[model samples]
Target chain A: MFQSDEDRILTLITRKLMGEATSSELEELSLLIADNPSYEILIQSLTHIWNTSPARDEDFLEATFLAHIDRMKKNGCDFDTYEQEIEAKRPWYSSRKLLVPVFSLLAVVAAFFFWPRQASVNTPVIIAEKEIKNEISTRNGNRTRIQLLDGSTVWLNAGSKLDYGKDFGGAKREVYLTGEAFFDVAKNPEKPFIIHTNAIDVKVIGTQFNVRCYPTDKMVETSLIKGSVEVLVKNRGEKWVLRPNEKLLVENISYQPLKKERNVAEPVRARKVFVAIKPLTYQNNDSVSVEAAWVKNWLSFKDESFAEVAQKMERWFDVEFEFRNESVKELSMYGTFTSESLQQALEALEFSFGFKYAIQGKKVIIY
Target chain B: MAAYKKLFHCLFPSIQNFAFSIVKSRQLAEEIASDVLMEVWVRRLKLMEVANLRLYLFTSAKNASLKKLKQENRFSPFSLDELQVEFISDYGNPEEILNGSELEKKVQEAINELPTRCKIIYKLAKEDKLRYSEIAELLEISVKTIDNQLVIANKKIISAIKYFVRKKS
Candidate 1:
């Protein structure tokens, strides 16, 4: 790579800031700055920026530590054993018991109120409240299994959030979902498990199914793995029962306003939703249905366009895809990726689809 | 145990921030940080054989955060590029040195606008005080890449400062 002198000086200055620059490199950097008096201010400012450290909130950290200790004790961590071990190693004069009073005082202080003092520029203050709303979320490239108090399990896919009130499983077993999740409802016929999404509300007595209702997706999908499920489209108030191994697709009517503008002549048609019931997708010789493969950690897709697959991959791998070639997005892709690195998955796609792709930092550009 | 508390005070913030970059949730990050530190105490005898305790803790934090995401059933691979790191650069002394808060805001925005990979590299090098070789090893990138990313970050900050200087003159 051809390096510019300015870039070279900046690199040397960075190395110096990180304490990685050799004496010769330091001399070279100084000489470069001396030659160009204009560079002095830049170098100084950069150095100052490098040396500057964020202010720490001692009070907040102390409160957090106290809370952490409380949680550890709740989780059955034997701090007394560790304390005895430490006491055996050290003399009584140097015992940790000396600081025990200070910690107790701090805990007393924290009990009144502990507000986060160190507020960063962009981070919003998250109030750590135990009651009110209980929310669990997973970021992209991650999945999590959550067990509710009702003995039901939910496998939350990436880029998903499940929110429930504190009264959950009390009067009604209801949850609001913003992305995709697989649910195994406990056998509670008295309390129907209901999931409220933007497009539809799924009600079930005791069943196993997957609900995908991402805000950006065109259709809300409900794939039943076993048992039965009842779905109600919010707009039309239409209800349908889903049997085992059946998938229901309901057009996301939230996008109707945008579509209404494009088809003003068919106003009645615009208000209607396209509903379809089909068998669950399965790859040849594979026991796992493609719809539920994500629960098993398999990124499976069958006859989905590259654009659609890219969206899934975005959540699956946490990388944004930019298609430079429009025609390539329409190419149909079929495969299952299990435990493959992002680069490896991309390479496999490139080989199969005959498209060139570049993996930048968190961005995958395809042509 | 006192030594352990001291270690917790020393390493908690950075580890929590590192976990926060990956999980993008404050509560989860805190849990992961606490879990990582607690593991050190639980497995102290076994961990004695491990070299580079700081790096080990960092690696543990990273894995713990990712593990929170994938859970037991999934086998998704993670890349550092996916991390949306929140770089907190101090504006206390630098504000007076840079002349005004406006320039400080500009510098802050510039730091914020740096590429995610660049931000992580710069943070690991400068804030976390990790060596270039250590950062390279942790991120699975070459030392030269870390060097280049730092330069890019410094260049961006310099340009932001230069813009303010130019506007004044």
Candidate 2:
């Protein structure tokens, strides 16, 4: 196959050693090697290097072994004789206190093995009501805000508590609350919201509203900010519809029938009271930004007395406040101020009134 | 003192002789063997599951020495592989020797010197043990191409050994 003498020679020599060669060239090398042994010796050297190339690296192997030993030691697997020696000298195991654990373990074993049979035979089953999952309780002056999975947000005012659970199962999104909170609920027409307070249940859909039910207060109030709500009384079965910007204040009172009239009865006129439930309102003026002013870091005081402000400050600064004279409670203020510093806000109130006040300990002596 | 004693035991005595047999230089063998062993220590994590630790370690050293020879020979025309004298050391007992680093290396160099087609066909025919027909089927060329690679690979190795042998004689 080779054309020239040099190519033929190269092919012939390669074939002679039985190393590697083309079939035609290989036939020539065999002819050459069969005639001469010198070429065969050269090919043996090439195969020698090929025999063990994969394993020629030594230090690579040693480093590999030492690393394994180090890893085993790192795992705290060194339970050597030193630990045994320390344990053998300890005297606490034979003490009576050790018997307590043994008995306790025996009691637990007894409960697992025996108690269920006795309880199943003796006690009747009573299904208990399940509790709501999510809860929020705000501190004295802070607004606790939470966004539900449905993208609805509940802003719990100071001294308020709220409880809700997985949004809705089949019928409606229901929540129970105490104290005061404002809710901005997402509009889902298929699922309406119902809030259960101590006095009444407020139900709505696609609405923003506030519910204030202070235990000490004489009335429970619900104020609709954007949409509609219906308040239902528990025993009376009375339903009151409150519209946007309208309010409802139901007195915390016992249901009493009107006193029976004694004298001559005049013909009763067609009554408006029979048709419409009387609406309730606290402010003769409009409700302003003061509703959630605390969320914006503003202390909104509307016709708030000095005593009321002092009560708030005491909780905010973790101090006790005492007024020497009762008339300090009569000095009321109306304004909005952010507390840059606790002392500065208090000074601003004092500055507005031009009143003399002393701060000795937590007691404010205002004259 | 304890650390020094531990290191003394950890050191492989087989490396120098093994490297010497491959690269055919005592000094280069020692350096290659030690460097390979140190690197083995650095990357010991990989060989945690390896069986036959001693054989494994010495083989790594032998590879390092052979690599040094190949790299050095690439630039300068000098090779430590003097053929006839180095043969017995290169083809030492596969079973009896703790490592085959020396022999593996010489085979590699002899093949590295082979022409392209010779290297491939020889690799296919001998190392892979493919028949002429099998190699032809795989390469999809004529059996002549496969036969040419084998012939060239063998002849190149044969010539390299002859040079070494002739120089010694």
Give the top-scoring candidate (DockQ): 1
> What is the DockQ (computed on Cα atoms) for candidate 2?
0.06
lDDT of 1 by residue, A1-367 (tens): 2247788888888877776778799779877876876887787677666655566667777898888788778878887776676447542223233333222222212211121232112222132334444888889988888778788888888999999878887899999998899998998999999999988999999989999988767788999987799999877789999977789999876543333225433443358788999878764323468899888677888779998999999998999988889988987766776666788677656534456789999999997
Q: Which residue ranges in model 2 land beyond 4 Å of their true spot?
A: A1-132, A166-171, A252-287, A308-320, A356-367, B1-169
Task: Give the alpha-carbon lDDT of every model.
Answer: 0.75, 0.51
Q: Model 1: residues >4 Å from true position, as ranges?
A: A1-3, A87-367, B72-76, B88-90, B93-96
Candidate 2's docking class is incorrect
lDDT of 2 at B161: 53
Q: What TM-score would each prediction reach against the true structure?
A: 0.47, 0.35
Q: State each model's C-alpha RMSD to the native.
A: 28.0, 35.9
